[model samples]
Structure formats: C-alpha cells, structure tokens
Target: MSNLISGRLPAGVRPQSYTLDLFVQLAEKTFSGRLLISLKVEKSLQTITLHALDLIVTETQLCGQEALVSIHPSDETMTLTFPETIPPGEQQLSLAFSGKLNQQMRGLYATEVQGETFAFTQFEATDARRMFPCFDEPAIKARFKVSLNVPTHLTALSNMPIVEEKKVGNLKKVTFDETPLMSTYLLAVAIARLEKREIRVGETAVAVWTLAEQVSLGSFALKVTQAVLPLLNDYFDLPCPTPKLDLVCVPDFAMGAMENWGAIFFRDACLLLDENRSSTATQRRVADVITHEIVHQWFGNLVTMHWWDDLWLNESFATWLACKIVDQWRPEWDFWLSFQEGKAVPLALDALENSRAIQADVKNAAEIEEMFDALTYEKGGACLRMIENFLGESVFREGIRRYIKQFQYQNASADDLWTTLERSSAQPLKKIAKDWFTRPGFPLIKIKTSGDTLKTLHLSQQRFTGKKTGTDLNPWIIPMTLKYEDDESIHEQHILMDKQEMDLTLPVQGSLKWIYGNASEAGFYRTAYEGRTAKALSEFAAKALHPIEKIGYLGDLWALSSRGDHPISVFMEALCHFRGDASRVLVSEICSYLEILSRQIVLPADHSRFAAFVDQQLTPLWKKCGWDADKDEDDEKRLVRADLLWALGSIAQDEEILSELPRRQTLYQARPHSIDASLVGTLIRLCALSDGGKRFDQFIEKLERSKTPEQRDHYLLALATFNKPALACKLIDLCLSNKMRAQDI
Candidate 1:
C-alpha cells in the first residue's frame, strides 16, 4: 500500500484499475505489488518499451475473435504476445512490433466503406491506448514515431509527411515524418484503399482520401477548407503548418468530425456532397463545420488542454475562432447568427436547468457524456464568442496565440486562457469569463418604452407578483447589441455589456418599435420586447439591417413564446406580420411554435383564426419564394415543395387542404429532385396527419433500408411525433441508446 501509485480520475474518465484491493484477506488473489508499468518513449528515435511488470490481465476484453494480445516483460524489451488468429497479424505483427516503432490514435479513424477498407483512429486521451500501449495521459506529452504495418494495396497516412514506405511479404511498412512533441490524442492515422484528391493551400498540401464508393462525396469535402484555410491563416497569423492535410469520411462515424493533426475523420455527410441533391443550407452548414474543425488543428489538437476540466479551453476557443474566420470567409452565409441563436440559446437554457455551469463535473463520466449535448458544445462556444466581443479581436487573437505558445504540447484550463488575455490587455478577463461560464442562465433586459424617451431596465430574476422591483439586479457585464430606430434612422451599438438600465432620450423616441437584446451576433441572450418592438421586428425581419440580426430576432421571439413566456397570442401576432417576408428558416420556426401552441391551447374553433393567419403569412412566400409547393419527384423541386406542404399540412383537417396532398405528391414526383431533411420531416408529418404511416412506411422503408446516418436522423424525428410527451421522450431515449446505432437512427 505504501508503494502503490494512484491518481484522481477526471470527469468522463476512469483509471485502468478503479477498484484495487490490497489487504492480507486479498493475498489469495492474483499477485499485486504495485504492478508498476513503465514505458520509454522517443519520437525521433522510434521506440517504446512497456514494462508490464506484474499487471495481470483479469477478465480481458482484448484477444477475442478479431485478435489476441498478451505481454511478457523482460529486462531487455517486453515481448508482445500477439495472436495468429488474423492472417495479416501473422505476417505484419513481426514488423509492426519492430523495436524502433510505435502506434498512436485520435483525430481520424479508417473503416470499410462499401468494399474498400481504411484505417482511422480516434485516440482521445485514454482511447489512444487502444491503438498502442503508452503512458496514455495528456500530461505526459511525447512525440511519437509511428511505423504502420499496412496492407500493400492500402495507403497509410499520418500527421506530418510520409518519409518512407517499403513492401515486405503481403504487408507494407510505412514510416511517417516525426511530429512535434504533443499530446497522444493529436496523433492521427488514416489508412485506406483510397484515392487522393490533393490541393496546394500555400505550403500545405491538402488531400482528400475517398474509398471507391465515396469518391464523389469526398471531392466536395475540401472545397470549403480550400477557401477558409487561407483566410484563417491570414487572420490567425499562423499558416496551416502540417505538410499535408487529409480528410477521410467514415461510414460508421460516432462523432461529427475529429480535428486530427494532418489527418481528419469526418462523418460521411459532413464531407460528401452532390450539388444536385443537397440544399443551399446543407452546403452552408458544411462550410461552417469545416471552418470549425480545421481551426481546431491549431487551437484544439495542436495546442490542447491538459485535462478534461480544461476541455472548454480547447473547444470553446475553437468554436469562437471558427465563427470569426467564417464571418470573413463567407460573409454572405451569415453563419454567426446561427451560432447566436442555435448555440447561445441552448447554453442559456441549460444554464437555467438543474445542473448548470459550462464546466460541470460529476462523480462519474457517463454523466459528463450526457452533458455533452447542444448546451455544452454550441452554447458554450457562443459565450466564448461574447468574450471576444468584449475583449476585441486583436486582443483576443494575441491572447489566443500567447496561450497556445505558453501551453503548447500541454493541457490548459480556462483560467490559463484568460491569463493570456489578462496579460495582453489591462482587463480582468478571468472575472469576465468566470461571470459567464460559472454562472447559470443569461441576462435578460426588460426595457419600458414611452414617446420620445426610453427607460431601459435590467431584467433581474425577480418574482413578478403584481408589485414590481428592479432592486435585486445582478447586472451581467452584457454586451447588448441594440438596434435603435429613430423615425427612419437605425443606430447600432457594438459595445455596452454591463448596465442595469440605460436611459436614452431620443427625439420622438415615442414607443420604440424594435429593441433587440442580443443586438447582433455580439450578445448572448434573447430579446423580450412585446408591444411595438415585437410588432416592428415581425414587420421588418425579412428586410432587417443584417441577415444575422433577422435570424436572431426570429429565434428569440420563437423560444420565448414556445416556453410559454408571454403567450401564444404574441406568436400569432408576430407570425402574421412575419409570414410574408422572412428567411425560410425563420418561417419554419414560427410554424413549429404555432403548431405546438395550437396543440397545447388553441381549441378546434380557435384553430381557423390562427390557421388562416399561417396560410396568409406563408402563402406569398410559398407562391414567390423558393418554397413553392410541388408533387414532382425531382429532388430540388420537392425540397421546397415539402416545406410548403408541411405548412399546409399543419392547417390540414380542413377538407380542401386534405384533398391537395395527392395533388402535391404528384407534382413533387413530376419534377424529381433529391429529398432533404426538412422535406423528409414534412412528408412524415403529412403521412401521420393523413393516417398514412403504413402508406408512408411503404415508401420510407426502402429509403430507411438504404439510408445514411444523416437520413436516419430524420427517421427518428418522424418517430418523435408520438402525440404523447411520455411516449415521445421514451422513443427519444430508445433512439439514443446503444441498442440502435446513432448512425442508424
């Protein structure tokens, strides 16, 4: 007991031996005197000697039908007991365990797509041990020399460049150029029977590896990076350093994408594309995510945090940096608004939930994985964006650069990140960061407007029981992006983060029409202005000053109304004004909220009034905009057609509307186009509404059988409409469980 070694397990991880027993009573058990294992590592001089000592393998998970593993330790070098069960191992294991060699994982994983097999590994922290035995901790950073015993027909790629490849027997031993000493997780390997599509982005050679069945999708994967990489290099003042960049799409990907240094692993949908079949939104989303993961090569993988608690340091910084580059890369996309609305809103929601805080830890790791939802990733990312808005870009970038350099090849906490910012600028960045990350919920400002004068007030979490009190104000250092309209004039405030109340005396400010809280992509909360402000936003959302602003306003209004904040009445009023001119996404959200409200409160008699408003609002757009209804089989025509049909179907049960489904279906097939997520969801709703699941399943069964992960995601949504909360939640749970693979959902 005196000589035993132990370390506290971080959240989301456990020690290899968690429950060790050491007592006289346990003497009968397998010998255990520390069972100390040591390893010597060198990147330049390829070698690793694992001194297994006496660590007995009890109830082993390794050495099954796939492969066998055993280790016999000696003073000279531990001999790996490899299994001859697999044919490749018989020939390859001798060289794979070549004394001057190593193995690593993470950032990429290769698998068989169709008949083509590829090698890809995701070795984040302890998982890297699966690839090869090592210290298997972030703190013990080391450069690795990898000697891969791959099949002769397949190509092996890793971080940095490939230095040599030689054939022996049926196996090819490929050695990679040495990488900088960094965490084990940054070590990536992608080997496949893949053809490469290469591009020169400055000094870096960008490559896309695709299996025969996926060559088409892989072609479009790097286009987004081809454009954004250069922009980011200029912005970050750090060129993409790896000699080669490779992206491989795996059919059975568990995560969206991994930012492996030099080699990246992506879900098929993220990398593959066909213009004829995909929607404009999907293209934009692809670009945005590409920007996000690529930036992580520098921010997350290249310079990573030491431990799981500081995971936010790597993730949130990358999350914000992606938005920063995306803004400059694709100005037309206005993806930042999506970050604010989609990312920030959920963070605020989760912070308000029972277990708040961006960096929450529980006794076990399974709990941590559960928290790794939209709130942790997206919303946490958005708050990081807000911090940048407060600190300014030059300061933020300098802070980031300094932080990376300071902690390069090591782990870092959120505090370490703020320390750089604090040193760079004379600001209390730690306090500012803590206020947002450690605190629960977002700041909501409630301002009262009167003619020619506006009385702005902070929205403290005060109980409103008739009598009012703005006394207990915890004024968030909020960067409120406000749009002040004076007559026909528009004024924008880029900075004004901390204030309980702002009193502005503008000439004839009479009844301020639209006052949004988040302002632009700068703020991190929703606006709650009902009377004239809501009316004005509803009227002006389509032609708003900025597309991003329009996106935010729509999201805020919808979320506030959906959670029963004000009333369903407000949504109806706002939808009436917004129906004619707005983004299709905005229109879709409004319709979603209206349907929920209709189900919850709107009586059958009250449905027509609200239903008519929906029809009138969406009609002009359906007629003139991209979402014109159709029954053609053409994918392009059907996508927009499906959206329009869903809007119509929501108002169905009306005899005339019910009769038009067959007509719409026919027209949709007339001009055949590929179906999309929204369209598929719409078709499902229509089928369920018309008691057409059996009929719907007839068409959908084939698609389901041949569906990719992305398509299967939509199938789960159709199942989500259980019409009962308990049942809907149960189905959601079922879909998430391991019983059904996430990709098959």
Candidate 2:
C-alpha cells in the first residue's frame, strides 16, 4: 500500500490506447490477462503510476525491457520504475496479470443462474482497475481493442463489434474492433450462452440478448429500441456513433442498467418483457430504461463528464433526454406525467438538512459511488426540465445539439454545457442555473392576494425544508408560469421570480375566476396559495389545468400540509375536487398521498372515519374502472384499475374489496396467466395482508414457483407485508438464505 494523498493518478503520464486480452475460465472462476498500453509522457521520469487492484502481475515490460514494479493496495495503484529516464515521448508498456473472477459484481465477475455460470463486467467508478492495470479515470480517455478467450459454447461481447474469431481446441479467441475514445469505466465485456433478437435501425444494428429460453421475451424491448434510436438521432442532429448496439439482459445485476459504449447491460426485469404476464407499469419501465441507456450512447459515452464531481452531467442529461425521446415516440404514454410522479422522490430527499448538492465535490471512489443517488438522477433531471421550459423547447434542442457536436468524443464539465447553451440560445443561463447545480434545496413560492381586486397578486420565495421552516436566505432564479382564467377564456403569463418578493398584475378584462401557479408543472419548485386563491384554484383545477398540472396542484398541497405549513384538512379538501379525475397518473398520485396521510397523520381513533373518507373518494372511480379488464382498454385505464383496487383494498379496506380478494386469489392461483397482469401483485399482497398465517406457506410455495424476475420480485415484496411477527422473522431468514440472490438481498 502506498500513502498517496490524492485519489487521482499523477498528471505527467497518460494512456493513449489499450489492447486488452483475457482468458476467462468461468468453471474455475479465474481470468488471466495481458495488456499493452500506449502511453504519452509529458516529461522525463524514473517511474510511472497507474491504477490496479487485486491483480497479480507476473511480468512487466517497458519498451520491451524489464521494469521494476511496485503494487499499492491502499490506493489501488501500481508504479513501474525504469533503470533509465524515460523522456517526453510515446512509450509502450505491457504486463501479464491474473485475477479471480469475483462474485462481488464488480470488474471481472461471475453470475450463476440455475447451474450455469457466466462472466460479466461492471467497471464504473473505479473497479476497472480490478480487471487490468491502466489509468482508470473518466478524464483519461483512450481507445480500446479487447479480445476474449472463452469456452467455445459461449458468445463473447465487448464495447465494439467482433472483428475476428478463431477456435483453439475447447476455447475460442474473439477479438473486437477498436472502440472510439472512451473512459475505461464504459468498457464492457460479457460471455454467456445467449440468443439475440436483432433489428436494423438505419445503419445501426440493434439487438437484445438474453438466455435462450427468454429470447421471445425480448420482443418488446427490441421494438422499443428500434423506435427510440431514430428519435434520439433526429433530436441530437447526429447519427448513432456505434455500428452495433446490443442490450444484454443479465440474470443477476446490481444496477438497473449500465450504459457501456455500444454494449448496454440491463437486469432481466428491465430488458425482458412477457407481454401476456407483464403489466403496463412494466412496459413503461422497459421503455424508459431502454431509452435512457440509448440516450447515454451519445450524452455520456460520446461526451463524458471530466470528473466524477460532474456525474450529474452524464446522468441528468440522459434522464431528461430519454424522457423527451420516449415521449416523442409514444405520446399516448403521457410519459411526462410519470416523470412528475417520479420527481417527488428526489424533491423529498432534497428537503432534508443532510442532503448534498446536485454537484457535490467527489474525491475518492467511495465518494463517487455516493454521487449516484436520487439527487443526481432525479433532482438534477427535474432542474434540467425546468430550464428547458425557461428556454423554449426549440432553443433548448438547438443548444443541446450544438453541445453534443462541439464536445463529442471529448470530456466536459457542467459549466461547459451551460456555456454552450448560453451561446446558442443567447440566454443568460449560468446565472440562473448555478444555484440549482451547487445548492441542496429548492424554493417554495408563496402566492398572496393584493388588495380587494382579483387582478393583483404578490409572490414571495423561500427555501422549503420539510417538517420545519427553512432559514436559508439564498434566493433562486425561479421560472414560473401563471395560469389564470376569466369568464371568457384562460390565459398564461410567464415570469422570472428572481427576488424574495414580487408583485404581478393579471391581464384580464373583467374579474379573474382563479389563478394557478406552476402551470404545466414546468418548474421544479413547489407553490403555496392563500386561502381564497387555494379554494378558487381547487374548484377549477379539474376543468382548467392539464392532467399533469392537476397532479402538481394536489401534490403541492399534500407536501405543504405534511410539513405543517398548512393543516392536513387543506390537502383533504383539495382531494375532493379531484375525485372525478380519470387520468391514471393523477389518480396514482392521489392514492399514494392518501396512503401517506393515513399512515402519518390520521389518529387511531379516527381510523374508521379516514377509511370511510378514502372509500368515498375512490369507490366511484373503482366502479367506473370495474372488476375486470376490457380487451381494447388503454394502458392508463389498466393502470388506474390496478391503483384503485390496491387503494380500495388496503387503505380504504372496503368491505366489497375485502370480500372479492379470496375469490381473486383462488383464481390467480388456479390460472395465474388468466388473471389481469396489472392486478396480479395487488391480489397477492391483499391476500397476504388479510390472511397472514394461512397464506404464508402458500406464498412461499408460489415464490418458489415464480418463473420470471418480475414474479419473483412481486412475491418477495408481498411476503414482507404479512402481519405475523414469526412470519416477519422467517421472511428475513429467507432473504439471507441461498434462495435469494445477493443483489436482491
């Protein structure tokens, strides 16, 4: 171990290219590799330091001669000392090394499914060192030519298309073409007995690979990839960089997905879909995750962040752009509404005192790992969406296209993106966006009525801290859109609320019926209205606002009430106006907020009354959705039915719902495929919660019989909901047992 102060390697020497060859033995769980790295040294030096971890280097040669090697396990680095000074010029370094095929799901690792073992690589952050010795950092970009020697029965894949293959006895040597300049973390290799469904999207060959038995399940993902690739290309005004795009479904994956140059890796649940047994929710997830990795092909791979500190640059852009392209492909999905619902998670997390900024300072590998949280993906994405609204869509699109073209195949910082956008749109963006990227919490805008007329309104901004009043005095440059209606028509006015307080006069002919802040839910900030304004907006929200705006309206009320800024009755009152709303996205938000209120605020003595209130609000919606599925029903209708059934059964505890559960459970057990896919998990959970002891053994049996990853997840989560204490302990034991995958636990 070396006492290196900095987590980064010294700046004098860097790699220009890597030729990595590995011989992997999955049965023996070991791999041996030989690496030849082309380096360019800036100045004369006696020693060169690079990154390596858990690797045994058998031989080291610099410029085809012997060199002294020193391994540092503490900082995961290796130094090679030459007998003579190496002047400032290009040099070649080669090493022969061996390492274990670890089970920790990092670097070169093995995953076992059933009785079969496969090798895969997950090298993001810093684990690339564990595979082979190189300068493993995002800023150090290098081209790679990878070759793998594996069993002849398996298929090997890497960052590029296969260039050559030859058989050597029981093993095959497969060499891939040279990849574009990329970070080491984005280099991937996978070896498995796989089958693929391939399609051609323009010049790019897109394929989804999975186990032979699940090849049919890759159909939906294949279609989604075909649809999204062209949309992304058109949006970026650039063609796909890679000639081949492969989406591999790993059986045991630690992350939802990893965007590895042309070879993207996803968990089974994210990439494989059984249409007959999969829910609309699963379909949406498959689309979103697939599109997200595709977007990264250009945003993160072509133009990467210079350091881990600006990781949000890679993730946030991918998150925002993926939604944009997917929405363009399937407008009927109402994907932005789903985005709004997902935004609440990070909004809540950001309100905590201990929350870190979107662009926090990251030093070591552990700190870099911590940056991949909800704040980086969700909050950062929401902020980007807000900025896009501030700058019109066309302008934002042009700015992004320019940014990609200018920084393609290079490294960039967050400020570089902002500067490019500012130049393209001629908008003063950095002044407004700096606070959002560097600050932890968002603002809460308060709307107050001025005088007796309905034309004038006063607005004030303050940081919103959950559960307490915030004292942070820094003001954000907030973009706001006010929607107000008169007797004749509705109108919109955009404002830049850059101060602590501001007053605006509505441009209405006569009297204003109501004014709703945060129209279209465009801004990331929350809004609070005065009593009269809140009442008027509530009355007109269902009719006047968009479905997403209606959700944002109620979501703000609930958030405000939860923090004691207003009474819980205020949110309850707002719920009444939305009782007749039919959008599944809005309904889902309402159900989730109601469940939270029931758990946190409702008194034990008033439980029955609260239940009755829930029944009154949702029963009619459920009746409209009905107990069965329609053959031609839209996805939203199917989703709404599932939401209503769950809320009515679990939260409201409606007698009718409770009575129907036993019959549904029996039907599901008899013919699970015959049941409505959206209702399967709900039925399983309702049965478990209602008949805990009797259903425990039944659930365990069903879990053992679960065929798909989705079914297994549903059963596992359902098992945790059982009420008995002994059953809870048994569930924990099951989680720790060999039956569960380490990733799941």
lDDT (Cα, 0-100) at 723 in candidate 1: 56
Scanning candidate 2 in windows of ten residues, the lowest lDDT window is: 1-10
Number of clashes found in candidate 2? 0
Best TM-score among the predictions, by candidate number: 2
Candidate 1's residue-wise lDDT over 629-675, tens digit each?
A: 34443433343455566766666344455676565555644643533
In model 2, where do residues sit more than 4 Å from their true spots?
1-3
**Against the true structure, candidate 1 has what lDDT?**
0.56
Candidate 2 lDDT over residue span 1-745, tens digit each? 5556555898899999999999998989999999999999899898888999999989888865677889887788998888888889999888899999998989989998788899999999899999999899999999999999999999999989999999988899999999999999999999999999999999999889999988989999988988989999899999999999999998778899999999999988888878778998988898999999999999889999999999999899888888888888899999999889878888889888778899999878888899998899988998999899989999999999999999999999889999999997787899989989998899989887655658889898888887566888778999888888977799988888889988888877777888988888888889988978877887888788999998888878878877887788877887887887889898999899878878887898988999999999999889888878988988899899988988888888989889988988888878887678998888888888887579887788878887777788788878988989999898889888878787787
Candidate 2 TM-score versus the reference: 0.98
How many clashes show up per model?
41, 0
